[model samples]
Target: MTPRRGGAAGGRASRVRRAVILGVSVVLAAGALTASPASAYLPGPVDDPLRTAGVALAADAAADTGIAFGACPKDSGLAAPVQCGKVKVPVDYADPGGRRIDLLVSRLRATGPASGRQGALVFNPGGPGAPGLWFPAVGLKSAGPVTRKVWGTAARTYDLIGFDARGVGHSAPISCVRPENYIHAPSPDPRTANAAAQTRERAKARGIADGCGRRSASMLGHMTSADMARDLDVIRAALHETRLNYYGVSYGTYLGAVYATLFPRHVRRMVLDSVVNPDPQGVWYGANLSQDVAFEGRWADWRAWAARYDSVYGLGSTASRVQASFDLAMRKLAKKPAGGTVGPGELHAAAENAAYYDQRWVTFAHQLSRYLHGDDKPLVAAEAPDRSGAKAAENGDAVYLAVQCTDAAWPRDWGTWDRDNSRLALRHPFETWPNAWMNLPCATWPARAGEPVDVGAWSAELPPVLLTQSERDAATPYEGALELHRRLQGSRLVTEVGRGSHGLVSIWNACLVSRVDRYLTSGDVGDADARCAGHPVPVPSGTLGAKDANTGRYY
Candidate 1:
């Protein structure tokens, strides 16, 4: 892949590189790692005393590649000293010399003994669109479950590295709709909307696609999982490593599986948390439909939990009554939006985040109860975007649509989409239509879709890898993880029995965390489908810790 000059606009800047891998530029410029180019691969400590201790540089491996690393800016938010770099890779692997884009990368050196140091541990926090540049920093922190459970022994032994994938944060991003379009636009709700409302929704989807084509037409077609997997290989080579060691959560599991399939021998030790389905039929459409069912089930779980503490919450004493209260809230929001902004669709979007993590259950329930009692401040605050960095948030949403729509073929027939969503909406009204509208741009997506990776084949040549999933996960259902385990030979599937949250590995399950830690440290998990009962269900009233609501796993 050739690295070409990029058009200057927004926060993007162009960087030039010599043909040779050595002598790559490393300038510590202003702002985030996304804004400037850094030095080529350098081994050892650069700055920052806290992180520089016991560091080992991969200068021997990086010397041959056209990649460099330099110290990050004063406020990169990394707990340790980290070296940041940029890699220019082909937009399309089929034509390596045709067009190119820079991929932003950051690395934190291992703090363990050099002799015992494992290679770089690559991380993807999912989202197919979430920025991972700060994830490694999260791993380095001394506090929090993510640092303890997910990172575990790997945190001490491996160089924790994170990168913003193609068309995502810090990497050349996909900017589709204008920020004004997102400000107060009511999300489409086919399940309850009138004929006129439905028409507006359909137009919104089409409008999103048209806007994407107008702004990012040339790069839209190349944002597939396959393209992303290829980028991982380039990063691995630049890291001066022969094999890839990965920890992928949510959508990142699919990305890791694709890399393993394309380059099986290059995989050393992998941990896929919350696995995506390997079935071709489920790539884009079936998987989402399945989520509707799973999310409903998870919501039921939440209702049951709420019922257990009805004396405190006062919503209801039974699951049915609690569900009724929720239904009433939605109905009220539909008739009159809270604070003149949060309609039924906005309420759904706000509550959807709560469905993924149990800790947020109290916050959401409190906010809803407050709204019903004639206060809209909390509800409006929930609906408001993070203005601290609106551009970053907008970029994430744009890349999300760009990658999901182009990764695999969505039904070209709007009739098929409409029929499926309409059918699902009958039994699964909670997320069916909202999810459909979120992805509706695919029906008229300007870019053609790519062939999905064949992930069902069981390859015996690859080394043993570990997989974890919650039995009641809402995003990537439990069945997908089982199917993935069945398809991938020499892999261990550690099941968090009865855990309803997505990204089960290190949130709060001690059994799951111990097993993952052992695997990453020793590269061994005895059984093919191991089972472990996770931590007890969180109570509604108490300030229980183990909260990871904002970690941004793909779900």
Candidate 2:
């Protein structure tokens, strides 16, 4: 379902969260392998050592003459006149001659003259599972003014390429549990729920893991980031591009980093927004823990914003009062769900949107105030339970687990997860438990774990890459950008000081868009890192309506 403004999937916030969960698992799978030289493909650790082999296979794969453009699928939801097609790629790179699958692709050809063309600018919208078939269209119709200007120039200079990475969207998608069987309600609140409730959550996680094993055993082992990176190379060859020019957001940053590590020489120009921490020790598990802390801070930011507009929301005149109001609502919802749908779990999920973007704060406050005042219609409509796209949602979740579970080894003992998350929940009450439960299936993932690519090993061989980040980004914290900057020796870092938005570049903030546009258009990596002051915090219009809402679009 297309998300409404100020509602669920507020632009890319909701969708980006789904991708964020899965993308968090991507970096955790790398083993402690030494970096490879630019000239050689180094094999990862023995747990899943096929990375080098996969790169070799991708290199040897036959080049496609070209993709034949045709009408996109009627249900694609892309407004631009984009042509959709598919290319066959081996399901397992190590066994290139074995089973093959279709990789769905979309493209909006450059409008400029042939001499001005700079080749394909491929995009991945961050989910290890999120589909990109609609990304090019998003650039055309949804970007902010500054971004629109940049995108307009890009449309004339590059063939904007978008694709559903394998096992996503229309590209041989995989599902673990049936739609009816899938569990959508949030797990019991770890902060207040009893041990029995938590145990039940554990069992639920196991059931999901078992279901995935039973249904998609063959694909589970092959769904690692390294494998996806191989698929990217295949995409590059099919496009007939000598070097890859890429843009990746959220988890896509990790994917792009992996691609660069694997094929440094083939990279032309790259942009990584909302950078992921490539530290092997922090991969999936530690990363989520860090995310919990970061989210808590963003939640505070939301509370302060809501408090400032207390005259409109009537929730509170101070941050602490705002928290109290929100907590009281949660308590009441636990007893009786608003509209018989938004229980404690759904309410928490709805409220979490505030952590991703400031634009949603007003909508969130409006919905919360209405719920407290006995009006549940808007809240219910905005955060209703998933029904129409239950199967597709399940597919994304399935791939999320598939890649993360096998990418790196998770703690096998439930005690470790309980101990770590329980201690963390005490300090960061906002997302610790819910985030832990969302990823609990990894403790017993069915596939064999693989080693992560040593992301820093070949940084020196890479072309000058650009990194953009917000100082207060909750999804991917600012420290990750610094870590990546240090790792990629020549990469330039652009910081949006005091901003909390998850995704940047063309969503808002003209300063960031200008830097990104200059890099894309002229290959200019400034002599030093740059910082831009964040846009002012949003103020409510005092009237709650669709007009005040920002559509889910950026990521």
Who wins the lDDT comparison?
Answer: 2
Q: Identify the leading candidate in terms of TM-score.
A: 2
Give the per-residue lDDT digits (tens) of candidate 2, residues 201-277.
Answer: 88989999999888887677888887888788778877777678999999899889888877776788999999998
| C-alpha RMSD between model 2 and the true structure | 10.0
| Total clashes in model 1, counting residue pairs 3 or more apart in sequence or in different chains | 13
Task: Compute the lDDT of residue 209 as modeled in candidate 2.
Answer: 91
lDDT of each: 0.71, 0.77
In the order shown, the candidates' Cα RMSDs to the true structure are: 9.5, 10.0
Alpha-carbon deviation at 226 in model 2, angstroms: 0.7
Model 1 per-residue lDDT tens digits across residues 286-398: 89999998988888887887787766666788989988887788888777777666776677776777788665676676676667677778778877544556667777778
- The regions of model 2 sitting more than 4 angstroms off are 1-62, 139-147, 183-193, 545-555
